[model samples]
Target: MADEMFRAPVNRSMRTLDRNSFRKVIPLHAARVPENKNISKVRSELERSKDALHQDRLGSVFPDPDRDRAKSGTKCVLLRPGRRKEATETGDNPHDGAEVTSPPLYSSVLDALLEQNIIDLVPYSLYLDYSYWTYHDIISAILPEDELGEVPSGFSQVGHVAHLNLRDEYLKYKHLVGEVLIDKNPGVRTVINKIDDVGEENAFRTFRYEVLAGPDDLNVEISEEGCTFKFDYSKVYWNSRLNTEHRRLVSTFKEGEAICDVMAGIGPFAIPAGRKNIFVWANDLNPDSYTSLQDAIKRNKVTSYVQPFNEDGRSFIQDSAASLLTTTQT
Candidate 1:
């Protein structure tokens, strides 16, 4: 039988059997053959076939184990595979939920491809899109007209940017200048040229004065509306923008309505609101603004309506529920 001959040892000189005869004899010795005989060779060939199939699925002639998701050790971010390319090209959400697209070709994929790429693979440098802005004066001062654009943009022009770059300027006259400007005159008004340099697409702004010149003391008193206030001078200067907005808000209040200015600064709005016959409670975090606010309140002669607070805004507001209500006994 063919199975018996196969187990016996294949001899080259043995007579060849026809296909039909070989098939007939295979069943005669089938029970004698061991189960574990050819499993290793079969598994190796099957793995080769699977690799080829996986490569083909990725549309490659040669199987690349790295780029092929099947061979990846990292967890597959299960997605509808074909839709990835389509979604990337169109910038549309593929998953139909709150799905967000990652940066094109994430670094993890790039790293895997780098490790698994075929022969003659050379790494490519990453390219980034950026815009740099600078003052024309600074750039012109740095280099000759012929050498223009050779130097980097001199300084950042954007306002309130976290990271900033300032180009080196050739300061030939600065050898003797160490802390030269001593009298930082806060009273001096700033001119436009001194404050900002006009540039393409951006304008820089700077403050002229010491920007903080106010009293430093905390004064607490109950306003006619029975609310406490504490003013801080340093906070008032730093938060100057809030002053204008507070002024606008105070203008909207109706006459005789009790209003509380929690976190008030130097009586910018509270004192002015009191002058308009509105009962005001002015409170501040800084002790200085509190004393100044109280003095300003007395100076303005609005003692009857404007009160001052020395405690935190939370405590004052928490304790002011009854005093805040203007309801009449029915």
Candidate 2:
């Protein structure tokens, strides 16, 4: 039942799995200790799981603001180890032992954003480098070296993802997969290489959806509508400046005027005005963002008054410039 509920996303070509009959146990062949001679199989299994892992994360890595502030514009962000360390008063082994601490993501983005210091510049996700945990490190932690060829440890293999919804909780179960490492779903799983030149597969096998901090995670309640979409830092834009500029331009247009935005990111001003039955032409430079605007238009069902354009905003307009006939023809 648990496996069914946590089943991998649907795949188009792979055989449809019987939700009930699916078994996740390691094969007896797999259990046989992999001898140096069987290293090839070990490599294949590692590659398969690794590929599946990449498919799991769709590749959105956001950066952190707090850490961005600490580094003096340096590329290095001081990451607290996964385990906290305790030191003895005596100099010998002064650093008694270390316990896992929160994982530190790479500081390149945090550093870059801080250095730029642009308003509305946000990091919706973060990418982490966890390649340090090699296959050897993973295998050693999961099995005694001698057992590497015979059979992998029961719950100590290199590539099983425990479905823990929360980040910290996921970290707790990290050892089951060999190491306690955290990385952006995409960066950790390089799907292209993992697929080994095979055509792309639909759905991911290991991506876990987690709300690190939000209305409930932060202990705050927000209106249902506000909490629907996951807030990504990269989605933050400098709308305040544009809003002011838009207002200034539109102020002179009297009560009824046609408005068009070459680059409408979220339709913030476009939707509200369009609701008043004003004609609006909203477009976006990015396909994903344009799709989002299109969705917003559909959700609001403002298609009656709002027109969408998906092509390059400038080119689309220039081509239509001569044919644009805004006034009603008698």
Candidate 3:
């Protein structure tokens, strides 16, 4: 009934109503309705009842149309009365596993309630919950097989920003998908669409991005395994996904080890290594990355072990490695 009324890809539409599905979807108040109540009676009782989610069709209400199911004591979903066209489209039974080619998508029961709500309908956003249903989960049920390419499995995040590289076909729904992500993931402060690649040889490897949702700030503070890094997410590259690798690599180096980071971007590996009392000669071609590395060194209190340099990787290795290596070894 929830899927029929709200339009979701819930169960596969059971040939026979499963007990677990019954318990999950069946509105408790509707099943308890006494006598031969109609939609009017069901609505009235549902209004007073606590589990009154939204509008009801008639699954849980009084005498089920078949009457045979009600006699058999089978709990069912609330559904509407059948008109000729509707009956033919849905078949004799709403439980017949008939599919709607295009159904409305909702993330949660509360979201549906907000749409079909009787009282207190203003803050619909507050009611939306994306835990069980993601934008992909909802859109897949509504779009045709050919359009399934539109939904992405997941996205990348740096700081509070969600970066999505959508296919050309999915461009139309970009804003919609972005909004869904913002609503679903409360931690995300912004959703950015990747408009272009990191083309220029700028130190930060900066790329073009268009803000799809939330505020415009790209600077973010990221908390990884046990490190905090702050940077302009757009101005520099920081992949939160590689945090484990940073820790894993840091673990391999023993105390008093001399480390040379030729392409250290914002001290992810270098600063963490320095925290373990290892000496680090870190260099980045990007001025922004060098500045962030300086800030992170102070923030992590590893200034004594980390030496930050703003120079090309080749120059840092050829001109500086011999002196730093000799000093650290001694």
Candidate 4:
């Protein structure tokens, strides 16, 4: 039987998943080691588990507000799996360092995940998705050996745009960085360097960027978890990496549950939930984000479910949520 999913807002630090922070989650059963080369087979295995908890929780890598403070560039949030049981069982051994056995269901899923390079091999953690690599990995591989230097491991992707914060030494290689990013990542057409810190009015979290390569157009469409979001890269904030989290959050709301999204940027969370027949009271301070969000709600045909507000979140709560709370309680 399935339990109700975790419903609280997860204030996870997006794009700041410390590799050392997560340990591997070994299951109680095991399947034969998957063919690492065939990602499709592994993906199919991952889909077989009917249990939602067995599904990868690594889907939404939320950002940490406190850690990202003073940092102006976009943060790369990675999907990490959630909790698992520690009981030991028997099955096919995984790898040379194998000790414990995983359950039959989890075994195939985990093994397949490891094969696709979709996940990392860490103790007490589930298989990591290897497709999500560190900026260091990308920079190190692309850097020419003749340069003869260590590469800084920091970069963040916001929608189709890759944001980098480079030191003085990297200024010269800015062009190469842009090229490598575009070549390596699909749908990424813009690479920009953050040259300044976000100002006090960080409502949009928008920062000044130096274009390194790719098209000048900052407008883009991002489709995630069945929702299509259209927004301007330069004016509003949108994290495409949070697709899993958006869907995860949406799953928690029972049908027709009313949600109040205070900082609903482009309705990443609001619009999708609305489409599921949930009622939403979404608010955003950024006029552009609010505008795009409305357009998305219309585009997704969720206008009946989402009520957009241009006012600040706090004021919206005071003016609107309070009344709804009383009405619902009565």
**Cα RMSD to the true fold for all candidates:** 29.9, 24.3, 13.7, 19.8
Residue 280, candidate 2: C-alpha displacement in angstroms: 1.5
lDDT-superior candidate, 1 or 3: 3
Query: How much lDDT does each candidate structure score?
Result: 0.37, 0.35, 0.64, 0.61
Query: Considering every candidate listed, which one attains the maximal TM-score?
Result: 3
Candidate 3 lDDT over 1-330, as tens digits, reads 444534344433233222233222222222222333233544454445433444322223333334565586533223222222232245456887785443322223323444454212111111112244555555565445677664564789887889988887777766666766786687888999888776463536788889877899998998765668899887777777787899899999999988899889999999889888999999988888888889999989998899999887888889777978788867
- Candidate 1 residue 274 Cα shift, in angstroms, is 0.7
> Which residue pairs clash in candidate 3?
30-60, 57-79, 57-80, 58-79, 59-77, 59-78, 59-79, 203-286
Rank candidates, TM-score, best first.
3, 4, 1, 2
Can you write out model 1's per-residue Cα lDDT over 104-192, one digit (the tens) per residue? 32233323323443121222121111111112322333334544554432221111111112223322211111111111222222111
Candidate 2 residue-wise lDDT, 1-330, digit = tens: 322322323322222222222222211111111123433442344334331112132221112234643243312111211222344234345486644444333233333433543212222222222332233333333443444363322221111121222223223323333222222232121111011111223111112233221121211111111211112212312222244565555444433556667766556556555656666777766555566567667766677766777778778677433332453111
Candidate 2 has an lDDT of: 0.35
Deviation (Å) of 187 in candidate 1: 5.4
Q: Candidate 1: misplaced stretches above 4 Å?
A: 1-238, 324-330
Top-lDDT candidate index:
3
On the 0 to 100 scale, the lDDT of residue 123 in model 2 is 24
Error of 1 at 32 (Å): 99
What TM-score, over all chains together, does every model reach?
Answer: 0.32, 0.28, 0.62, 0.52
